[model samples]
Target: MTDQTRISVGLQFGTQPPLNTLRAFLLGARAMTLDSVMVIDHFQNVFPTSIWDRDLTWLAAQRDTPHEFFDYQVLAGYLASRVGRMRLGVGVTEAIRRHPVLIAQAMMTLSHLTARAPILGIGAGERMNLDPYGFDAAEPVSRLEEALQIIHLCFSTQGPIDFCGRHFQLHSAPMDLKPARGRVPEIWVAAHGPRMLSLAGRWGDGWYPATVVSPREYAEKLAAVRAAAVAAGRNPAAITPALHRFMVVAPSEREARAMLDTKVVRAFALMAPPSLWRQAGVDHPFGERFNPLVDFVPGRYDRETMNAAIAAVPSAVVAEGPLLWGSRNQVVARLRAFGEAGLRHVVLAPVSGLVSPRAALYSLWATGRIARSLRRTSPGDGTSAPLLC
Candidate 1:
C-alpha cells in the first residue's frame, strides 16, 4: 500500500481526569490540531470498585483523589457540541451494558449534535465491568454477535425493528431517529482474537484493537480480518485497521522512561498474560508464578498488596511491552512501523503520574509532530492521504 493510505490519529480519554480537567485536555488537544478524540466507556472507575469497599486504607487514600470517570456517551456528545472540527468517538462500548438499539440511538444523537457521523466502537464485554454490575459475563462473544446484528439493523433499516436472538429480543422496536444527513456512523469493533476478528471483518466498518498488540501480531490479525472479509464477500480494504496505544512522550528519553516506569504502567503490563506476551514475541519473566491476567481480580486485593505485586514485575518486561515511550523521533519511528503494518488509525492514551496535565501536553505535542511527519511524507498516490486535522 502507498502513503495514500490515510492514517487517522486521535487521543483516547483515559479513566482518570474529572470532567473539568478532561474538558481542558480536549481544548489543548484541539489547539494542537489533532484529528479525532475518543473517550472510554466504563460504568465505574477503570480500577475495580471492590477495592474501595474491601480496603479501608485505599478508601482513605482516595478521600481527596480527583480521579473520576464520566460516561463516554455524554462526554462525546458534549465534546461534539464544543469542539469545532475534530471527530468524536467512544473507544469501545460493551453490548452487555446497553442494548444495541439504545447504542444506535445514542450514536444517532451524537451524529446530529456533531453535524457529522461519529464512530461507534463496540466490544463484547469485560468481566470487571459486567460482574460488578451483576450482569452475566458468560457467552459474551455470542451475545456481542447478536447485539451487532441488532445494531446494524437499527442503523441500516428504517421504521420498527424486529429481532429475535439468544440474548435479546425486539418486537417492532421503533428507532426513528436517524443519523445526520442520513450518514450512518461507522461501527468500529474492538477485537483481538480469531472469532472477534472474523466478526469485525464480517460486520464492522473498522477493526479497533488494544495497545497490547505487537506490530507483527497486528499484521497477522489484519490479515485474518482481510481473509474473513473476502470470505464474506466484502472488500477487505474497506475495513479500517485501528489500534489503541498507551503513549508517554517527553523531550528526553530519560524523562519519558521515568514517567513510564510507574506502578500503573507496571500493573498494566502485568495484566497481560505470558501467553499474550509470547504471542507478541516477548519472553515474560514471570510465567505461571504471576498470572495477573487470570488470577488478579480488581477489588479482591488491597492497594498495598497490589502495589507490591506490580513492583515485583521486571522493569525490562514493562520496557519491552506495547507502550510507546521515548523522544519525538523514536516515537515516530515506532509509529511508522505500525503504519507499515497496515494500521490506518491510532488512538493514543497518555499515561503519566496520575494523568498529569504536563505529561498530557507533552504527549499531544509529540502526537502533533508525528501527525505532521506522516502527512508531510505521505505520497500522492491518487488515494486519500492522512490529514492532521
Candidate 2:
C-alpha cells in the first residue's frame, strides 16, 4: 500500500459523445494527474424517460445500447490503443448479464493490449436488464460472489477453470490469453452493502462505492469494508477505496447551484430513490401518485411543471448533501477531507451537462488544481497495509 495520500482520479461517461467529449475527459484526466479512466457497462441507456429524447443522439454516438451486438469490448479495445498510462476499466459489468468466462476474456484481451492497464470492476446485475432474461436480481450477493470466484480462477490459471456453484458452473474451460504485462489486471467489485463488502474484502483488489457526499460517509464505509476484509482473513488496508462523486465544480457556488437545478436535480429525479428526497425533508414534486421515471414521452415536459418539480426538493437536501458541488475551493476542501479519511482515489463524475462545454472546461481546470493539492499532502503512517484490495 502506498503511504502518500494518493489520489487516483477518473471519469464515467454521462452521455454518448462525438469522441471529442471523451477526448476532453482523457485530456482533462491527464492534466489533473489522475491515474485511471472508466466507463460503465450497460446494454441500454440508464436515464429517465423525460430526458431520453434529449439524450438519445449523444447516447447512440457514444455507446452500443444493451442487447446490441456492438459492445464496450470493441470500444475498450480501441480506447486502449489510443489512451496510454491512465488505467481503463468498465466501472462495473453486471454479473448476471455476462458469464465470468466472457468477462475475464474481455478483461484479459484489454489487459494484454493495454499492458495490464485495464482493471475489472464487477457488480451484481440490474433487474431492468436481467429480469427479461429470466435472471434473478434477488440473488445478487450470491451471484456476484460466484462470478468473482469464477473470473479469478480463469484469470490466474493456465488450465481450464473447473468449478460448480449455485449460480454458475465452469468445467475445463481455461483462459488461453496471457496478460502482456507480468502482473494480472486488478479486479474491483462495486458494492454498498455489508454482504457484498465481505465478498470484496475476500477477493477484490479495489472497492468502488456509489456517489459519496461527505467525508464522514466515506470514512464510515471504508471502516466497514476494511473490517470485512480483515474478518475474511485478508489485509483490509491493501484494498484501495475509491469514490465516484457526482461533481459540478464552478467558479462560484451560485453557478454550481443553478447547474444542479437544471441538470443534477432532473437527472437524479429519474434514478435515485425518491425516498431520499423525503429523508431530506422535502416532498415529491410529482406528487405521491406519480413516478417521475414512467416512460417519458418526448416534448411533453411542461417547463413550469418541471421547474416546480425540481424546486419541490430543497437544494440543501437534494443537491448538496452526499454530493460534491460548489466553487473550486469548496470542492478542494472536501476532497482533502476524503484524503484524510484514508481514500486513495476519487472519481469526479460531473453532471451530464458539466461533462460538456461549460462544465468540462471547469472540470479540466479543477483536475490540475486538485492533483497538485493531493501531491502536497502525505497520508499518515498510522495503519499497516491491510488487504482491502
Candidate 3:
C-alpha cells in the first residue's frame, strides 16, 4: 500500500478561556504547523468538582483563580469565527448530556462557518457532568452508541430524522442544517474499551486514543478497529487512527521532566483520579488505581483524592510511552516510532500559556522539533501508514 501519509495535529483545551485567548491559540496553532485546534466540551472549570476543602488548605493555599465556564457550543462557534483553514474540533462532546439533534445542528453550523474544516469528536461523559443531570452512569456504553447513531443520522439524513433506541428516541424531526462543503464534519470517537473501539470502526471516521497508550498498544487497538470495520462491511483503511499525546519539550530530559512534572502534572493533579493512577501501575492509599489512559483529571473526583491519585502515577513512565516529552531529538524519535506503528496524525495537548504568549508556539515547537524529524525520515520505503498483517 502506498504510505499516502499526511501529518495532522490538534491542540486540546479544557477550560473555556476568553474568546480572544482562544482566537490567539487557534491562530498560533495554525502558525505552529498544527493541523487542527480542539476544545474539550465540558461545564466544569476545574476537576473533582467535589472538594472537602473549600479553601484547599491541604495543598498550600494558592488563591483560586476565578474561573469562567463557557458552554461548549458558544466556545466552538466563537472559535470557528477566527480561523480560516485550520481544522476545529471538540476534544469530545459528551453524548448523554447533549441532545443528538442539537449536537448535530451545532457541528453543522460550525462546519459551515469554518467553510468545512470541522471534526466532531464525541464520547461518553463523566459522572460529574452526567450525574447531576440525573443520568444513569452505568448506561454510558449504550447511551453513547445510541447518541452516535442519532447524531450521524441527523447529520447525514436529508430533511426529517427519526430514530428510536434504548437511550434516545427522535421522532422524524426536521433538520435543514447542511455541512458547508462535503458531508457533515468528520466524526471522531474518543474511546478506550473494546466495544467502543469496535463502535469507532463501525461508525467513526477517526479514533482519538489518549497519551497513555503505548505504540504497541495502539497497534493492537488499530488492528481491532480494522477487524471491527471488516466485520461491519466497511473499508478498514477508511478509519484514521490518531493519537493524543501530552508533552513538554525542552533541551534535556531533566528539563523536560521538570516542566511536565511541575506544570502539566501539578496543574492537573487536583483533577486526576484513581483511574488514572491505576493505568500507570501505581497504588494509592484511597484504595483506587489510576489509569492515566482513560481518566480525565478534572471532573472525575475531588481535589484531595485527585492530587493524591496522580502523585502515584509516574509521570516519566506515562511520558515515555505515546507522549513526546524531552529534548527535540528524543521527542522526534518517539513520534517516529509511532509513525512507524501506523499512526498518521498526532494531536498534541498544549497545557501551557495562551496563544498570545506564542501563537502556535506549542504547535510550532512540536512541528519544528518532531514533525520536521519525521519528514526527514522519508516514510522509510513509503509503507508507514499501513497496519502490519
Which of the numbered candidates is closest to the native, going by highest TM-score?
1
lDDT of 1: 0.72
Error of 1 at 252 (Å): 2.2
> Candidate 3 residues 1-389, lDDT tens each?
12455455566765454566666666666666656777776655443435423333222222243234578788778777766677788878777677877888898888878855588888766655555557666777788888888877867788787887887887778987777766368888877779989888888889887643457777888888889889999998888888876665655666556555652344444234444456567554344543432334355466566666556547634454444556656666666666666788777775422212242254356544465445553644332332211
Question: Which ranges of candidate 1 are over 4 A from the true structure?
Answer: 15-17, 47-67, 276-296, 353-357, 378-389
TM-score of each: 0.86, 0.81, 0.81
Q: Mark the 10 consecutive residues where model 3 has the least summed lDDT.
A: 54-63
What's the distance in Å from true for residue 201, model 1? 0.4
- Per-residue alpha-carbon lDDT of candidate 2 for residues 1-389, written as tens digits (9 for 90 to 100): 23476566776653244567667667767665567777766544444344433232244344443123226677778678656777888877867778888888888888877744588887776654564456666777898898888888877777767898998887787677866667577888787667877777888888887744556767887888888888878888789888777666677767766666654344454443444556666556655544332223223445555545555666555564555677666666667667778778777666634334566667667766755655554533222222111
Candidates sorted by TM-score, descending order?
Answer: 1, 3, 2
By summed lDDT, the worst window of 10 consecutive residues in model 2 runs over 380-389
* Candidate 1 per-residue C-alpha lDDT over 1-389 given as tens digits, one digit per residue, 9 for 90 to 100: 35555566887775454567678778876876777788888655435433333222223253343225677777777788876688788888888888888898899888888855688998876665677678777888889899989888877788898998899999998888778885578889988778999999999899998744467878999999999989999999999888887776778777877765655556667665465556555444444554543234475566666566666666655676666777766666666677888888888776642445476567767777766655555533222422110
